[model samples]
Target: MAHPISFLKGVCCGAGLMYFMDPERGRRRRSLLRDQCVHYCHKATRAAEVVRRDAQNRLQGTVAEFRHAFQHDEPADDVLTARVRAKIGRYVSHPSAIDVDASGGRITMFGSVLARELDGLLAAVRSVRGVGEVQSALRVHDDAGATPDLQGGVERRGERYDLMQEYWSPTSRSVLGAAGLGLMATCLGRRTPSSMLLGTLGLMLTSRAMTNLDTFKLLGLGGRRRGINVQTGLVINAPIEKVFELLSDPQNYSRLSDSIESVEDLGDGRYHKTVRLPGGAEAMLSERIVSVQPNELVRWRSEPDSFVPYAGAAWFNKLDDNRTEVQVCMSYNPPGGVFSHLAASAAHMNPKMLMDEVLMRTKQHLEGSQPSREEGGERTGAAASTGGHPAGSEPQGSPRVEGASSPAQAGEPVIHNL
Candidate 1:
């Protein structure tokens, strides 16, 4: 059998040709209807794609905005909930309901929240890192106000919330997690049914117990003391020595990082540096050069405060040609260990995520031409100390290194074999 679409296209083309050849009004009229239908279908498909893309973009933005608004609160209840409700209300055919419970610290909504909209809501709810759960007791409704009666039903709906009750339900997460562990154990078949069941139950209990234990011990955890470490490569078109020279100069840091406000060389390879934060807060950080071996390696330790302790080090390995691999590693002990971990989870502060950013900027700095740099004029004190003794060579019992470098000194940038 012939393809129906192909046959229709052929018939339309033949009829068009016959009309043009004979100048018959009837033939032309038939051709025009077919052409119009095809054109309209194409336009409809394009329109649908545009609508889909726009919807996706809006959803992503909503999720991001909601997450930003609720990053810290548990069972978050704030303007974000209202904002989301408004956004969702726009799409639903029903008037939405939002209930904010300050006493219980929860936000609940109901009334015609669709399946697709659930993702945005869930994402917003989960963005609050410590949020225990997101209870989506939302339902979809099809009542759209006035019928544009083409094919689908028109209905309006909304959602309901219970602020007094917990927004997150741990029971559901536990069940799913336990099920996953049980399935894994069954596939392994390492033990008898009774033993397997007991083991799985024990695992689940242990997991929950550990989480509870952490919750109790949050304040004592060394979360604030520990920090993240990152390493990234920067390949300069110039010689490795040139790159090392530029890196060793404390004044160049501002060029490497837009965040650096100033660099005061103290002597040796150390400097007192100031950095501007996102909200215009200037942080005066005491950074000591822990190690410096010409262009081979340079490491530093930064303690923003007595509580925010972090150490970062990097080793420069020169690959053949102009490329260099800078290996960076950081160690941090967050304050209060696990207890204050939640407080430190915010971006621009987290050790792990911050390390990534540092690496990325480091790469950008070395790769790009020097931008603006603060004056690294004369030092009021002795030569700024190096970041610390060259990494592995730091005396076992020596104090942690922190310092900056002067702008005048140029050093070779080659990895020296131990």
Candidate 2:
């Protein structure tokens, strides 16, 4: 089966090359190839520069470490402790909250502090003189309140999403995109079946990389989401009211995703939804509409009885009389820990993909187009509602209410499962 698929793909590529290299169109194709080559070359140069700089920094650090070890013995216990404390204090805004202790070249940090502050505190302590090992006994806290365990470390709500974005930022995309393009160009220039096969692989990679979609999880280049946040957006050629109406109905969900087996309305803006996962497994969720501003915004959160804790919001902006931009954002903590996150990320089954497909289907359905098989049929019930403006009116802006998650920005990468 795999061999046949590979053969067909090769044949398709050969045919595409013959067409693109036709006498009349060959010049244009050649020009495109040249442009792509130049673009990729520049990207390669930038990447090389980054690598060189990083290598130099690492080398310098190593040299400095060796020099220090040779020149000075470990400092006295009290002196080392003072130095470690000062180092930790410099990195944190609220040093008073942190209590640092040093004994036998080991340092222990005890305090109630924000999660983001932990990494720096540990690093700083390790860099101090006479510090052999660092132990973090600190209690971490976020806006949500106190947390006792600091083992996995607490991350800010969207830290994973932010990291993923930085990883696949425009610059990173360009570099990968150029590599893909270069491969295709090489195949075209070579004009051989073997080259075509390689080009096909390149094309696949390029398509995935250029779209800001993280499809190469097997290679570990895919985005990572943390602490339950997913944001995605799409533009629709319909008024805000019509789009909002379509999304508010729970029935439309099945049309967007086949995974959604059923949605049951539980009244008072609450719903019980059953979902079929990839392996015939099923999970149920209880959700309630927390906020609604007609045609402008809608938000929902998981009920206490839900398996996964989650919150989400959608925002509608009128781009024009015939076009509206819709944004959806979701944040959830998956049931299991790191292993579950790895599985979901590797499978590309994260919430960002879910919202992406949903928004795409919503666009298609509202525009009277048939939803793709990859996307499913519409399910029924209202998931959320906002009470601000009428359709097509200028939104006063999202409400100042507490607990409302922000809508996903277009092309923003979100962490999933983590």
**Highest TM-score among the candidates is held by which one?**
2
- TM-score per candidate, in order? 0.33, 0.41
Q: Write the per-residue lDDT of candidate 2 for residues 1-418, one digit (tens) a residue.
A: 6599899999999997897789998887677668768976996677566646655776798799888876655677788878876675566655666787777788887887776777877776777767889888987775324443333332332223422552454434555668889999999999799999989887865755543434433233322222434566789998877787767655455445444566777778787877656566667777788888888988887777766566778888999888999887765556443334445655555566567656765666667664334223343211211111111111234211111111221222232211
* C-alpha RMSD for every candidate: 29.9, 12.9
Estimate every model's Cα lDDT from 0 to 1.
0.45, 0.60
What is the TM-score (0 to 1) of candidate 1? 0.33
Question: Candidate 1 lDDT (Cα, whole model)?
Answer: 0.45
Q: Write the per-residue lDDT of candidate 1 for residues 1-418, one digit (tens) a residue.
A: 5699999999999986786666557675576568768976996576456546655776798799787675655444555455555654434433333332322334455434444445655565544334444555565434333433212423423343321221212332334446656755664676777767767665544343223323222233443422322233434454567556655545544433334455665666555665444345554556667677897877776544423455666666778667766565555444453323334343223333333333344444555533343465432211111122112222333322222232211111111110
Point out where model 2 deviates above 4 Å: 1-226, 371-418
- Residue-level lDDT for 356 in candidate 1: 38
